[model samples]
Structures are given as structure tokens and as C-alpha cells.
Target: MNPINYLYLSALLFTIGGAGVLFRRNAIIVFMCVELMLNACNLAFVTFARLHGNLDGQIFAFFTMVVAAAEVVVGLAIIVTFFRSRHSASVDDASLMKL
Candidate 1:
């Protein structure tokens, strides 16, 4: 298939993820949408790397994956902690930063 098609799909996935992030109230759902956006970016990166016959985009994508993995670890920890304390995973319910 064409590289442009991959890019188009990536854009669509990113758009859907962005909309979910913006409209969703559930923390887990927002987190999932963020992951979806990251995966869309990774797809675009791999597609571009193949198109250009280079490893730069692939390297960037790898780093992104690494960061995302760390984010998942820490993010889930926080979410679980908040859920245990507040009993709700809604973003609006989190005012944990309140003084």
C-alpha cells in the first residue's frame, strides 16, 4: 500500500484520540486515547522511515515507545492510587493537587 495511505490512517487515529481526550471524563479512557495518539505517531514514524530509506524515524519512534512505556508505569500507578483513595477514576474527580 501507499505510504500516504498510512499517513492518512495515522492522522485519522490521532484525530479520534484527540477527540477522546478532549471529550472523555474517565481518566482511564483519556489515558487510552493518549496511547492511541502515541501509537498513531509511531505508525507515521515507521511509514516515513520506510519511505525515506533511513533509520532516523525508527530511532525516534523507539524512543517514543520507551517514554510511553515509562509513562504507562507511572501513570497507572497514579491512577490506581487515586482510584483507591477517591474510588472514582474520573478526571474531574481528581483535585489531588488542591491545597
Candidate 2:
């Protein structure tokens, strides 16, 4: 596929993910949306790496995936804790920071 097609697909996925993050009230759904956005970015990075015949983009994408994996672990832990404390996974239900 062409670079433009890759970019368009990435942009579309990113937009959908952003909308989900913004519109969803559940914390778990928001986290999943964030993951979607990260994967979309990874797709874009790999596409550019192939188009330019460079290893840097692939390396960056690898690093991003690692970070995203770490984020998923940490985010899920927090979500689990929040659900335990609040008994609900809705973002609006957890306002401990607002105090």
C-alpha cells in the first residue's frame, strides 16, 4: 500500500479512538481506546519505516509498543483498584483526585 493510504488509515483509526476515549464513560473503555490510538500510531510508524527504507521508525515503533504494554499493565492495575474502591468503572464515579 502507498504511504498516503497508510496515513489515511492511521488517521481514521486515531480519530475513532479519540472519539471513543472522549465519549465513553467507562474507564475500561477509555483505556482500550487509548490502546487503539497507540496501535494506530505504530502502524503509521511501520509504514513510514518501510517507505523510507530505514530502521529508525521500526525501532521507534518497537519502543512505543513496549511502552504501550507497560501502560496497559499499569492502567489495568489502576482500573482494578478503582473498581474495587468505587464499585463502578465509570470515570465520573472516581473523584478521589478532586478532593
Candidate 3:
């Protein structure tokens, strides 16, 4: 398959993720969309690394994955805590957290 195909797929995934983050009402769905966007970025990084014949992009992707993993841990914990206190996981309801 052409490398360009990977880039196109990455772009599509990123776009979908962005739209989900923008339009989704559920907090969990938005979180998943953010993860999807991160994965799309990893894909693009790998593709660029392959095309350039260097490890820089791959290394950057590795670090990104590490950070993303940490984010998942913290983000899920917060989500669960919020869910336990609030009955719903709707993004609109998150505004109540300000209090």
C-alpha cells in the first residue's frame, strides 16, 4: 500500500475524533475521541519516520504513547470519580464541577 494511504487514513481518523470532541454529549465518548486523535498522530509520526528513514518520528511517537498512557490513567480516574458523584456523564453536566 502507498504511504499516502496511511496519511489519508490518519487525517480521516483525526477529523472524526475532532468532530466527536466538538459534538459529542457524553464525556466518555469525548475521551475516547481524544484517544483516537492521539493514535492518529502516532500513525502519522510512524509514516513520516518511515518515509524519512529515521527514528526520530518513532521515538517521538513512543514518548507520545507514554504520555497518553499516563493521561488515560488520570483521565479515567477523574471520569469515574465524577460519574460516582454525578448521575450522568454528559459533558454539559461537567460545568457543575466548577462548584
Best-performing candidate as measured by TM-score? 2
Ranking by lDDT: 1, 3, 2
Q: By descending TM-score, how would the candidates be arranged?
A: 2, 1, 3
**Residue pairs with backbone overlap in model 2:** none
Candidate 2's displacement at residue 12, Å, is 0.5
Candidate 1 local Cα displacement, residue 4, angstroms: 0.8
lDDT of 2 by residue, 55-92 (tens): 89999999999999999999999999988988999999
What TM-score would candidate 2 get against the native? 0.94
* Predicted candidate 1 versus true structure: per-residue lDDT over 1-99, tens digit per residue: 666999999999999999999999999999999999999999999999999999999999999999999999999999999999999999999876888
Q: Which ten residues in a row have the lowest lDDT in candidate 1?
A: 90-99
Whole-model alpha-carbon lDDT for candidate 2: 0.94
* Candidate 1 local distance difference test against the native: 0.96
Best by lDDT: 1
lDDT (C-alpha, whole model) for all candidates: 0.96, 0.94, 0.94
The C-alpha stretches of model 1 lying farther than 4 A from their native spots are: 96-99
Error of 1 at 22 (Å): 1.2
